[model samples]
Target: MLNNIGLPGLLLIAVIVLVLFGKGKVSSLMGEVGKGITAFKKGVKDSAEELEKSSADAARDVTPPPSDKDKV
Candidate 1:
């Protein structure tokens, strides 16, 4: 369905949006959307880092150091 919407269709949609919500409103809305996207990306990055750190920690805890008795 969306594949049929070419440049003209996008222009029409933009005009309609501008008319319904004035220039300032649309601009602010777009700014908020941008901020939301940035926040989402940051959250994803932090979560991935936390996961990696936890996995590394768990790996260290799972393996014990060799004892002196084993050297015999």
Candidate 2:
């Protein structure tokens, strides 16, 4: 059913929304939506970076084991 809503349907919906909300209200709403999307992307990037940092931190040390002579 939704697939049938092609460009014409979308345009009609947009027209109705614009008429109901007014141009300025719709513009501000779209701006807020854009900001939300940007914030969400940044959050995802930050989360990925944090996970990478944590995994790098958890890596095993490359130094050789201590010799038996070094034992007490």
Candidate 3:
């Protein structure tokens, strides 16, 4: 889809956006979007770590008991 937007088309769209929203609103919106993306990434990383920790704990709790076949 984006490949269809050549340089001239992209420039025209950018000019329209600038005229409609101005620089300040666009920059502020971009900043908020970046922050949201960063926060979502952090949340995913934290959840993955927590899942690893819980799986490790569960594995430790499932050890086999010692057999008495050779208690000499």
On TM-score, the candidate that comes out on top is: 2
For candidate 1, give the lDDT: 0.98
User: lDDT by residue for model 3 over 5-52, one digit each (tens)?
Assistant: 899998999999989999999999999999999999999999999999
Which run of 10 residues does model 2 get worst, by summed lDDT? 56-65
Give per-model TM-scores.
Answer: 0.82, 0.84, 0.75
Task: For residues 1-72, write the lDDT of model 1, one tens digit per residue.
Answer: 999999999999999999999999999999999999999999999999999999999888976789999999
TM-score of 3: 0.75
Candidate 2's error at 25, in angstroms?
A: 0.5
Clashing pairs in 1: none
Q: Which residue ranges in model 1 land beyond 4 Å of their true spot?
A: 64-72
lDDT of 3 at 66: 70
Error of 3 at 71 (Å): 17
- Runs with alpha carbons beyond 4 Å of true place in candidate 2: 60-70
Cα error, candidate 2, residue 40 (Å)? 0.4
lDDT of 1 at 5: 100
Ranking by lDDT: 1, 2, 3
lDDT scores of the candidates, listed in order: 0.98, 0.95, 0.94
- Residues 6-68 of candidate 2 have per-residue lDDT tens digits of 999999999999999999999999999999999999999999999999888767566778999
Q: Assess candidate 1 and give its TM-score to the true structure.
A: 0.82
